[model samples]
Target: MMKKPAMQKSKQWNIKGAVHLAGIFHFLHSCGSGCLVPFLTLYFRHLGLTATMTGIIMASKHLLALVWRPISSVLARQYDKRRTVIVGSLLSSALVVLLLLLFPSAGIKAESGRCNTSQPSADPTDGSDFTTLESINIPSQSNANVYSVNHKTIITEQPDELSSTYTPTLVNSSSNWSIRAIRSLRNLEEQQEEAPHTEFLGSLKVMDAQQQMFFLVLFVIVLWEFMAAPLEWTADDGLYEYLDFVDATGRHKGVKVWKQLGAAVGTGMVGILVTKLYCRTGTVTEFYSYTALMILTAPTAALFPLYLRKRERATSGGFKALQLVYGNSQALLCAITVVLTGMATSAVSDFLLWQMQDHNAMEIHMGISLALAYLSQAGFAPLAGRLARFLKYHGWLMVLAVISLSLQCLYYSFLWGPWAVVPAQMLAGFSTGALWWSVTSQCEDIATPGTEVTLIRLFEALSLELGAGLGSLMVGFVVQKFGLKILFQGISVILALWSIALAVLKWKIPRQRRINYSRLLAADTSEVSESESDQEKDWLETAMEDARQGNKWKMDKF
Candidate 1:
């Protein structure tokens, strides 16, 4: 008996160790991707890509991940999860290295001598004779060379040859010559005179080479994104597994706390590093190098979970497991809620920078707002967890999240100043933090007993990714069309409707309490089919006998 207790204690310790390891992995991964990926658009802009093109590149990653997540779920089910995680991590790290190597840090250099040096000549057809055209000397304080032209003939003079005189040969234009024709002739003369000196062959070749390199680097980054998709799903699955273990030991909140704390520290570190390294140095390569190092370290942290003795329960395999969970109406409703939550959350996240910029916020102020947003999330996550426990209804917690998110949308729509938005970000933090925790907890509750937790987590992850991808993609276009203020208003209205749908679902669907199937199966030794039929017959016979006795009693009383 003592040995059994000792083993149980050891198992608990191992489980806790695994949870901490997972948190560390989350931290490292967050530090890497979170810090740098958000700046990818800025990097592209620096490379002379337009905003529309940059948006397409960034949105493509999420769009591809949306499809990759389902495949990742299947792969996780088919393979050893530990191996899958290791492979995913290794591939992600390798991809990061490749991306850094391919990234175009040195932007295209501007070519010298490209500016047109010739001055605009007045048309002689505008009632001006050739003899009256004196050499006009426009005084420029700058050191740039200036050229003056004669109307009747092509006379070219270098800046140093300003003192040289030229006699103009008169050419009479017929009265039929239109103003357009004369203007075209003047433009042709200017082009012909400046063409030789303005064209720099070496610079042209270099710029073309840089453009090709930029596109190649972009293609590699997209490929890297495709490969990184599975890693995200595997990590979340591992987290859910850890949550299950900790919940069994009645320390689930501790897991959430550690995860949130890690995320907070990681997010804070990103702000600090970006300010210190990127802002101070202004070197893109240095930033990439730091991000690459962080990503490479994540795999090693992920390996710690494999050392834990605790193993995830085996899945039932195939679409059967998915159907079992998603077949239920309540589960379907919960999924819809999750997707809407994701849509709203992602829209706000993708647009916050733009919103701040519209309000004329400085770069430092924008950074502060983002930092506060992330910190608030980290700080409020555990508190939200406790609030959920206090309420004892995860659904209500989701409602609270929705309400908080609604308020956040409203706050962002009507911003007073940049500093004012920082305090408002706390509401966003609460909403995001609460929604994430509540959704996961609720998923566990609704998941069928004996079903693999990974499957449920996968579904949750898919909903989030799909919603976020679609939201980011669509909201970007919507903002482009309708402007930011209108976009926020539209999002606010949609969230309100989503909240109503959730409330209706909550009212209609009965809450599912977790059932211990192991204890239930162990308690019943007899064959279910044989006992069930006999019990049904006996119940019918007893009901008939009771009816007869009631009739006899009624007759005697009468």
Candidate 2:
């Protein structure tokens, strides 16, 4: 049996190792794939693409990513994870570097450094503004790479014979192009006139800046998956809230795209963090001891999963031992977890939105909401720890938390109108905090010993992303269709029903209780004569069984 000090050392090493590798992949992904989605629309516009065209491109990108998610999951399941991580990381990084290097400029260029495509040139009826051109042979070029300069639109071409080779096409034939050009110039003049009187938005500018900040933040704290994804999701919600509001005014579309980009990267970071944390630490709070059990297990749990083992052992050994009944039951539970957590979070933000009834108070709302949300996460950790002790069954604890928040959210949802959403923020605070506690702690029970915590954490990442994605879409739809009240009511009912289903499953399991740790370890040591294969299997089984039982008496009783 591993001694206490030795186990502690092992756990520390594991945590460190997982953090190191996870950080590297997280950095690469954040800078590469992470940055691309946000800047895509901006880049498209830089190429003079219309808003409609840009939107179509972005939709296609999202659709493709959605299509690829299942494929990614399958690859994760079938291939070696290390290989997958390495390939995805390198490829994503290389693509980003290549794009920036090849296309160094982000916007259009003109003969005059300051050029407006929307503007028409000065009147050329007289000789002063117009220069007569001799009819010359012009080389052929692709129309795609051309843009209008001064009074002429032109394309560049190379000649087969050498000498001088480029040509320009001037369309002065019917004056139809001139008519269109004059109409565009009139619109530009009108836009310039209206630019000053439009409503100035302090919240939106801050929101956009926050979005840009999150990208750098993800790169800085890529080591912890939990840090990136959760923070990013929350940050995205904040960014999106403003985007939704400003959509009412059409002028700020460019700013709106930037805000969404921030949200994506921030949320993506959160997803990465969740998975990495799970792989390394058996407990979610491996980095912190906000939960009592994490504190108890910190000595070993934090350090155990770090060292790189033979690939076979990391994958094959744990799978044989865990033998989890992964089917409809697990899916149902994961879904419930996603929906409840999502509903609770959305409700809180919805409440904040309602409270900020005045345009002037928006910044105050943003600051207050963020300060309170962050505080609640830190403050509620200990309370969650105490509750975990009272409710030993991971399933029951999760259910109770969900049901309580759901009912509370429902109450706030139907209370009045906009004012009702304000009081609901408390439920939001509690529910969001409670979710991290339940999901992470529950993961402790589910993960196999000798299995990389990365795998379980990856599941957590996926669930959280699915939750945020679904939640945003659902809340937006409900608010638009049946109104805010109906959305809250729907979430309430969903959470309550899901909780009961999970509670029922928990009762059915009837876990076989084990003795305290010292006695268990003593027994384990005595049984060392078992074959090597059997010994490893026995260790993995016992560790997980201990997590499920959460019977800390084993350590203290000895």
Q: Name the top TM-score candidate.
A: 1
Measured with C-alpha atoms, the lDDT of residue 435 in candidate 1 is 72
lDDT of 1 by residue, 1-558 (tens): 355444444444466666667666655665555455544544554454433444455566667877776576556645656445546654565556445443433332121112232432255353211122122222223333222222333232234322224212223322223333333433444444456754665333323323544566557667877666677556555555555655542333454444444444444555455546542334354356445645576565547453233434544443565575576666666667777777776667666666775576444565556666667776775476457657756677777778778878877888767677876777766687777676666655545654545445555555567677667667767776787787778888877777777887887887554444553455454423443345445766877999999999999999
lDDT of 2 at 290: 17
lDDT of 2 by residue, 1-558 (tens): 975654444322233343333333333333233323322333333333333333333333223333343344334334434233334333333323232222222123211222232443356442122122111122234233233433355333333422322232334333344444333433443444456544584333323222323333323223222112222222222222333343321121223233323333433343344334432331122112112211232232222222222333223532342343242354346445755575455444433233233222222233333333344544566577566656654455567667767876677555543233345444543665566566555444444443323334344444444444445445644554575566667878877787787678767754422223442464555433334336456767978998966767666677
After superposing candidate 2 on the true structure, give the runs of residues whose Cα lies further than 4 Å from its correct spot: 1-335, 343-361, 411-423, 452-455, 500-505, 512-558
Candidate 1 lands at a TM-score of 0.62
lDDT (Cα) of model 2: 0.40
Candidate 2 least-lDDT 10 residues: 127-136
TM-score of 2: 0.40
The per-residue C-alpha lDDT of model 1 at residue 367 equals 53
